[model samples]
Every structure is written in structure tokens, then in C-alpha cells.
Target: MHEIQDPLFKPFALGGLELPNRIVMPPMTRSRASQPGDVPNELMAEYYAQRASAGLIISEGTWISPLGKGYAWTPGIHSPAQVAGWRKVTGAVHAAGGRIFAQLWHVGRLSHTRLLDGRSPVSSSAIQATGVNVYVAERDGTPGFVQASTPRALATDEIPRVVDEFRQAARNAMAAGFDGVELHAANGYLVNQFIDSNANDRTDAYGGSLENRLRFLGEVANALVEGTGDKGRVGIRLAPLTTLNGCSDDHPEITYIAAARLLGEIGVAYVHIAEADWEDAPHMPVEFKQQLRAAFPGALIYAGKYTAERARAALEAGWADLIAFGRPFVANPDLPERLRIGAPLNAHDRATLFGGAAHGLTDYPTLAGSAA
Candidate 1:
């Protein structure tokens, strides 16, 4: 037998789970979850099972409660039906010898009333989020992007309920057979609304100074840890500099490093950094990366438009413990094997990226003779 000397192929331990390689398939929303209920289905199960070769797989953002949703056709874990749906997905992945984690999410102010059962959306503050469109369906079932509705600030008394929602989501994820859970604290969602300076402007415990702003995240992280029953089963995603959906911190370095330290103190398994991947976006500063490493005591995974070379370089430089690929995995279900052997990847159909069936979802072919 021949051994691969490449660092990407090397196995590493992420908390209590031992990963077979350094390639991670981070969460990417395909919006194909069964509609009328927002439940995971056979199609989603097959889609995930096909890509189980990654060192770890994180499921697409899953809403924790009815109000946590932000888009159409995305799945939720708040209901028994939704949990049953996710069971098939997790079973399929484990059958293929893969480990998967659920990405618990809430959109916060980045939501429209149509998706909220004609009710106003809630967030850290009563601010209207703009600059990015939320995906929704009209009365006629025609789906398109629309400006989000102005949201009401979560009442001081109501904040704990939302945190409990996250806790419940983690418990549901474990019941659904997920190996672990990742809090979708990144992006301009509920947790990020509380974390980002510009998005949150409250005089309450969840806003004002950095420590106050970080209060919500700490509470949610602690809840998730307690709900999961093991600190090693929890992970967090954070975007320090990315301003997508208007979620930029006043001082990204200070904000995210402190977040890393907080998660470290909470003893979550890992912290996944989501870099700005838009065209011509500025690279994350090395000094900031170094500080994040110093602050956090768990595995560090970075994702954003990473190529094979860039992934390897990050691994060798001690910058990232694991490297995650998003778009490439869509075109190549056997992405890990393809990367291991330097095979050409198939191009993904952008037209079929969102709200599609098997065309771009599970129809991607694998290596000719291999079943992966």
C-alpha cells in the first residue's frame, strides 16, 4: 500500500472525534429541503450521503424555531417531523462512514414577514437589515429576493427563550443522530446581530460595550454546550470582517479575538472562521489569525474560496487546523478523493444552485469505478 504524504490527507483529532483528513465540507445552503414543512427529505439525505468523504460534514443552516427561519425550502429542527427528516440524513451519512454536525441557525432581522407567518421579525435591535435580499415566495409561490422587514428588538425577558431555542435545537440535533452541532453565529443572523457593533444598537445587556454584545453569544454557546451534554460536540462559526447583509463589527480584530477567547473559555470543540470570499475581498490579516489562534484553544477551520494549494499552505503555516471547501464540493461529491489524487473537478451549474432538484444536487458523478 502507498501512503499519501500530503498534509491534507493526514488524519487529525477534532475534540473527541477523530477525523480521517484535513478537508472539511462546510455548510452551504442549497434550499432543497422539502417544502410546506421545511423538512429534510430523501433528496437531502442522498445529497449529503454522496459527499460523505470529507473529514467532517456540517449540514446546511437549520432553523431552531419557527422564527429562526429566513429563507424558503430550508429545513428546521423545531418539530418532530423535521427531526425525523434529519434522522434519514444523518443515518445516510453515517452509513457511508461520515461524521456530520448540524449547523443551528436563526436569521434574526434578516427576514421578511411572509416567512414569519405574517408577523414581524425579531432581532437584537429593532433595525431593518438591508444591502442583501432574503429569499422568499410570494402568494403565488413565485420565489425571489426581497428587502427584509424592519424587526422588533427581542425584549429583555424574551432573550432567554431564544437562547433556549438554540439549546433545544442542539438537543434535537443529537436526537437526530448528528455526531455534533455547529452554531451558525456567523453571517448577519441572530447571533451575529448581537455580536456585530453596527447591527446592534441597544442599551441593554446584549449591546453597548463589547462584553455586553458578546453576552448573547456566550449564553447561547453555554446553552448549546449544556444541551449537547459534551463540550466537544459543539462548534461555532464566526465572520469577523465580512460585511455581508451589513454585519461588520466596529473593530473586527478586537471583536472576533474576544469571541474566540469566549468560546475557548466555554470549551466548545472548534471555531470555524468564515472569510470574505466575494470577488476582490480583502484577505484576513495574518496578525489577526495569529491572535485568534492564541485566544482559542480548540481546532481552527477556515473556509472561503480556497483552492488545493491555498488549503495546503494554510495547513502547513499552522494557520488553520482544517480547510473547508464550499462551491467545489457541489460539483464534486467525491471532493476529498479528487483532491487526494489530483483529478479534474466538474463545474457546478449556478442556475441550479438554489431551489433545485437532483439536477445539480445529487446527479454529480463520482470516480468511474469507485462508489464514493
Candidate 2:
């Protein structure tokens, strides 16, 4: 590959912000937030600062409310201290000359009472995500994964409160010094629960038809934009084909195509599509890609098992404006530089992917050190 002419290195404008490259570090749940309050800390700052070379960094999924939290040690953006903690992280990233966006998240049916202070998890419908487990603290404070319990469906009046929570979280993200925010409307979370018909069994206006199903997502997107005071600073992520966390739509193409069109009408900054990456994963047809490109007026970002070659191909094809590297950014803090020079990458250690200290988080060496 000709490194000089690589599209990944080219600059692109995402709304009002000018990105130096097309590479994005999409959100990955590291589960490394500080104890007691689940706040951001200096260690997390160092981790993000180390990978500042990426054109953009979307933070790990953060809960918008106490009820939104689903995993152990994942951070929250609902409190003053949490906001203060994230301020340090944003400062570190900005000082290193990088831009960051907080990924606002709320896990609905994917939670256990252990994580919800004895309150049952809520979704658009009362459904249990079978065969799915969420990370939690054990009896002795050890980290473990437990099967999620059946969730309660939100009442019609309660829908507005959910929207308000997201609105408040967006304001909190701005107060925490983030450049922008991304809605985690994927992977069977609260927003995804509303979007996916299988997870949402409501007969009310928030469910039933595709249009009704998209109501919650539309409300949340508008809330985020209004709270942030900038439509260009807000982005929403959707997974059209992912079965992870038991999220599926009867007709993915119809559901997501309509979703893209709705988001385009909303005039948000961008739409991030999370592709399935596991072995034997279903393929996303070129036809769907074309339809999605036509539906969404804003920039499009694709993530999930993307390699340099595939990323380049996608950019050359003219559909994707940015490509996100999830696990690669976890191990290679200087991933952009490594890709630019075609240097070998450090393999990520799966054991320490979550709930660990700096050993697997920030201890990975750069190319120069590895060569030396």
C-alpha cells in the first residue's frame, strides 16, 4: 500500500469539527472506571492520552443514570463528581491534541438487580435477554458475569423521564469537557431495545410498527441534540445485523434503512453502523450499503473487525467517511502511526480486556520500544 496516498491519512470534516484522519477509536467497554462512584480517573486519562493519534476517540459506554448501569466498574455521567472526573480525562486528551466524544449508554433488559439497587431493569417491554450475561461484582467484590433477570416494561408516562435522563446526560457530558457525544443505540441497550422489534413487545405508540419502534430513538436523539445545543456535535450508533446481546429485528434492512432516513431527517451529525465481526457472521450486502448511503445525509462510520486493507477499500468505495478500530486500539495505543508505517501490531491480551489495572491497558509498548 502507498502510505502517502492512503485515504485513512486524509483529513475529513465531521460537522463543525475538522478531523485530521479518517481513523476513529470507537467506544469499547473497558470496565476500568474508579471504584465507589464509578468515576473517571488519571489512569483512564493516561490510557486515552496514549492513543491520541486517532482522528477521533469515542469513549467507552457510560451510564446516563443509576438504572442505566449494567456492568461492574463502568463509568457514569450522572453526578457532579463523575463529571469532574471526566474533566480530567478530556483535559488529558485535549492536551495531547486529540478530540473525544462520550458514548452515552443505557442497558435495558441486559441488567440484573445486583447492578440496579434492587429495582428491576426496564425496557420497552418485559423481556429477559436469554443466554446473555452482564458483568457484576460478586459477593466478595470479585468481578463475575451473571445471567440477566426479566425486565419490566416502561409505562407510557415513564418514557418522557427516560428521554430526560438522556438529555441530562448529554448536558453532563458537555460539562465534563467532551467535544461531543454519541448515543449508544446498539447492542440491545435501552435505545436498541426500542429499535429492535424482538426486544420490544409494546402495543403502545412506542412500539408495534417500525415507525412507532423508532419513536424512542428519535426522541433520545433529539434530546441529545437539544441538550448539547449543536446538532453537528451529536452522533447515533446503530447495529443493523448484530445478534450479540440478543438484539435482532425481523427485517434488518427495512428497520435500519428507515432508521437511517429518520436520522437524516433529524439532521444529526453522523450515523455509526456497527457490523457483525464474529466468525460466521452474516454479510452486509453491498445493496444495503448503497441504500444506507442514500438514506443518511450526514457522514457514515463503520466499525467491527476492520483491517487496514478493508478500511481502505471501504473508503475507496465512497460509502464510509470514517472507520473505527475497536480491539486494535485497545492494544496498540499508537495504532495510527503503526498503520501509517506498516509496522507490526501488538496482539491484545483477552484476559485483561476488562476490569483490570494498567497491565493490559497502558503497558503495551510502542514500535520504537518493541524494536529496541
In the order shown, what is each candidate's alpha-carbon RMSD?
Answer: 1.7, 1.7
lDDT of 2 by residue, 271-357 (tens): 999999999998998789889999999999999899999999999998899999999999999999988988888999999988879
Cα lDDT tens digits, model 1, 1-372, are 778689899888987899999999999999998877999999999999998999999999999999999998889999999999999999999999999999999999888898999999999998887666899976676578998999999999999999999999999999999999999998899999999999899998889999999999999999999889999999999998888887888788999999999999999999999999999887798888989999999999999999999999989989799999999999899999899889988889998888878998999888874545
Candidate lDDT scores, in order, read 0.92, 0.93
Q: Which ten residues in a row have the lowest lDDT in candidate 2?
A: 1-10
TM-score against native, each model: 0.97, 0.98
lDDT at residue 2 of model 1 (Cα atoms): 75
TM-score of candidate 2 relative to the true fold: 0.98
Best by lDDT: 2
Model 2 steric clash pairs: none
Which candidate gets the maximum TM-score versus the true structure?
Answer: 2
Local error of candidate 1 at 103, Å? 0.2
